[model samples]
Target: MVAKEGYRNGKRALVLLVMTALLLAACTGKEDQGKQEPEANKPKEPVELSIWQTVLNVNEEQFMQEYGSKIKEKFPEVTLRFIPYKGKGSAIQDLIAAGQMPDIIYASVGHIFFGVLDPQLQFDMTELIKKNQFDLTRFDPALIERQKQMANGGVYGLPTSMDTLVLYYNKDIFDKFGLSYPKNGMTWDETYELAKKLNRTEGGVAYRGFGMATGAMFTVNPLSLQSVDPSGDKARFTADEGFKKLFENFSRFYNIPGNEVTQQNITLAKQRELFDKDKVTAMFVNTGAFASSTYKDTMNWDVVSLPSFGETPGVGSQPIPTYFYIANPSKKKDKAFEVISYLTSNEFQQYAAKQGRFTSLNDRSIRSVYGDDIPYFKGKNVKSMFPVKNASPTPLTKYDSVALASLGTQFDQVLIGPKDINTALRDAVEDANKKIETEKGK
Candidate 1:
């Protein structure tokens, strides 16, 4: 009986020892599992990208509200710092000179020459685009083509929004004048006749019939005239016959006995104030219609497709697009590319379009949602925000802005001075070519 009891004790001890060994091995495996994860599964290192745009009067907070927050929600790893242009001290040149150039820059088609390309801030995004397999076809083909042309066949940027001309007419003015409201498909000639009827005085107020943005006729002409040729680095004011037609067609608007498009009224602000605040201007044509303008609360207005040129019956104003550019000085090129690329994604584009910034995408569904969320656009004819078709783009170069300025000088010369179209065009071509040569040097 004693020998059997001792053997039982030894068997029990061996079972207890085996259970302890197994428990130790299980704990060791758990400790090994608690180590750092594999590189592929690891959290991305944080990166902050700084942005600087030519958008003045808009503060950093406004930019973050409109744009930066959208980028942050998608990329928690990225922090965005918007550098605002406060004055000459914070200007693009000032920033670049201080060696404080930002990682990203923003500007529209017309300003890109001064804001990006001329400053040598443009970084060719081609390789980053190829590496990331970004599909440029997602954007409006016209926008992509313009972007390519803007860089002389190299893409330095991607579009964020689009703008085109529209005819903005105050409902009150038309009602008071007892004229039919402006219709979308009317020719410029037809619209001119309408403006003529409204050119009159009411209660001693001198209500002008029409006013225009100084750069509008020059930039968004239905005639597809570029102030300068893209590759030749030469001005086109006198060379292209379109200039004569363009000058003649609009020159008549100013000739009305009672309604003259004044020199100061040539400014967009002057036109907007005359149309919106003064409520005296009968017809005004420009981009950033009531929905995006400051006087949204002041005016009862609606839009039509920018009056068609009789020659190009269905053509609309040239598309003016805004782009996001990554700077050559960007240390975070890969991440910066990712940031701008993601902004073009359907999700972000849809969100922005709803807020009244027109989509850069080719998606009609997205385009249809423009201004859905803006208070000013409620019940407004937002469809008129688009023309029958965006006017086919003309090739552009860095010198076009200079030429456009020259054209503005000539526009005033013809309207306010004795210069005719031929004389004005000749002087403009000479002045632009000379200035362009200076631009080339600097």
Candidate 2:
């Protein structure tokens, strides 16, 4: 059930239910799409594999369950039961506490710190990779890099999908203002001037230059107000002048009189209600926003790279990968790995790319999966994300949630009050360092 469109498509790649009863029967005839097996004279009993993944949206949930049916044809004897959960963290927590961990679990990039940051929670998959003779070379190099960092050669997880952040802008507004489309290398200064210039005042219906998620807070990582130096594991958010300069630019846009935003219908639903209404000039959003923007087919929009600071090369944008990990507690580790391999393999990723989800694991196959040009990407500037490549997680101790909340509190202070940028930054840096030091001692 693959639906193809001009730019976007959907692959309801489904496996027949009958094929599940005869796993190897169809494989003997079909070419090796995945791993090739030497014919064994004796047949072993099939294993039942229980899997769990968080259902954040309708499309993703459907892809998982529906794809499961298709993979069943290749391994009919192996049963895959996918249990749905809500938050990635909560799902894993509940499963762990209940002593009912699934063989495989879908994990968000944000939640990866919870597993990899803690050594005890992770299962060393190095042996499993060797025993199965799993070719680590099959995965994308970027995916392999992150996995190596987290696993420390343990190979605990497989990246399923990749998501990148870009600046989404309205086309009608650009046309009305007689402004040219945003270029890939636009700097923050240029973007700001354009935003200020394009703000139409004809009807006294003031429009904003940009709208950012005030609620989304991060003190570290590439998306944060600060970041660690990739070369050194040291917190450079405060020390790094580059980050400070970026923050200054960020604050300047928000400080604009009309740009001061709150979480109204205008704020919460950024692209749909705000940008589409021609109120906002641009927004920093993920690839998912493209889907929602075009579902109505009324909004004419384009994407560009995020703005950069003065002399530094435009850092481009940051993209996070969607991936899944198998738990060691499962009784069916072998079957679990097989299911994971299938889902993250080029075949399944190609199926997902048809749905317009951001995919980077197998770009060659995605090129074949999609048509010449996707309207969602039409006229949109596509820039590679640099932040994701250099991103490092913030300290995640037992009190990580508390530390984040504290950071949020401080951010609110700066957002609401009249505080000098230097003072605020110094205070935040000192406080965060103190906390990190305390955590390290613990």
Candidate 3:
């Protein structure tokens, strides 16, 4: 009877052990299945990234036709949707109010510098730049430095196109006056002397020597020159030595014997007519004006580096760069950065250069091949667009636009003989300070 009882207990213990083992195996299988399910059900679709550009001329359909295929060839799993916003105020503001923030924002350095597009609204690209080992040296040092300044020492954007000030001369006018073409790397003083030679009344019609578009006189100066001090809420243009020098240099051109007609007399609208239709203007200081189709078939023109100030010998004018900024609120930041990287890549820059678009890259090979694909640029001195260093961007204040306009009016007064340089500058300072205070009150 004792032997039978011991066998029964052993049998019951084996049955309990088998049940426990089966229960443990079931729990382990569920966990394993849970882990594999996510992988098995992962989405296999491509992500679509939206990009917004404020400029009207930039067509998305044209972009997709020209460059979209190249991007797709590289990143098949990513798609780009380009959105064009043509409006007055800040396009970013409109987008934010409408809750339509895109993955990328296209803007000018002026817009970014002046706080139109808030820097905090952009993702700091410094980390991604380091992770991807991007060669910042591939671009002009001034351009990279400008980006840093705009972001307060953080790289928040990348430049797509760089437009620098150049001296555009009418070949016909130069030839008619028996003067040689303006050479690259000439100083403002040397250029002024050349302008004197070209300023004359020919065939009973007045032909001005040298003329610049309204408001472009500021471009030739250093970026540090500002009309107002944001920190102190004061006007700096009156006391700033840079402004004094700028006024003096520009005054020399208009004060010439026959060229004293003043910009107000001719007006901005007539300035282009003078250059294009009348052909009375000999040398003009402009940026990207010669690239227009209006001049492609009509005029004989060539460009040279802008006349530099003797104080800043080798440095040319500040570049007007168009920047591409990544949205800070984007869910596809990594993908957006990839697109920006590809856009600024060597292959893309070369393609852009061929389209007659100025590339921001400092690559000599790309500069050599600039505008080669465009038939209008054939036999033109396209290589002359480069060779000079871009001037550093000036720091900006919130009141810069108003202050600059006020100061510009004062400068115009000086040019038109309504006020002397000192009085005009003093009055401009008071006017700018008042405007700044008004803006602060608002």
TM-score of each: 0.87, 0.72, 0.83
Pairs clashing in candidate 2? 7-374, 9-354, 15-70, 317-385
Model 1, 1-442: lDDT tens digits are 9999999999999999999999999988898887759886788899989898886777878888778888988888888888888777888898878878799988877778678877888888888888989899888778888877766677999998888877888888888878888887889899889888988887999888888775876787777787788668899888868898888888888888777655766566776788777889888887854457555656888877788878778687788888999999789988998888888889999998888888888888998888888887788777555776778788877677788998888888788767888999899899999999998898
Which is superior by TM-score, 2 or 3?
3
Q: What's the true lDDT of residue 426 in model 1? A: 94
Most lDDT-accurate candidate:
1
Predictions ranked by TM-score, top down?
Answer: 1, 3, 2
| lDDT per residue as tens, model 2, 207-308 | 666654433324332433334343433344467565455456666666676666443433335534676554455444334435433423556665665555
lDDT of 2: 0.56
Q: What is the Cα-based lDDT of residue 203 in candidate 2?
A: 63
RMSD of each: 4.1, 16.6, 6.4
Across residues 1-442, which tens digit of lDDT does each residue of candidate 3 receive?
Answer: 9999999999999999999999899999988887785763665469998777666566777667555777787677877787766565436677677777788877776667432345357678999899999888888877888777656788889887777767778889889988999888888999999999987887898888888764655733544476667679788876657888888898789889887765555465576677777888888877764664456757887777788877776567777787888888898888888888998999888887787768888888888887888776777776775546777666656667777777788877887886888888888889988888898897
The C-alpha stretches of model 1 lying farther than 4 A from their native spots are 1-42, 230-232, 262-269, 437-442
Candidate 3 clash pair list: 223-394
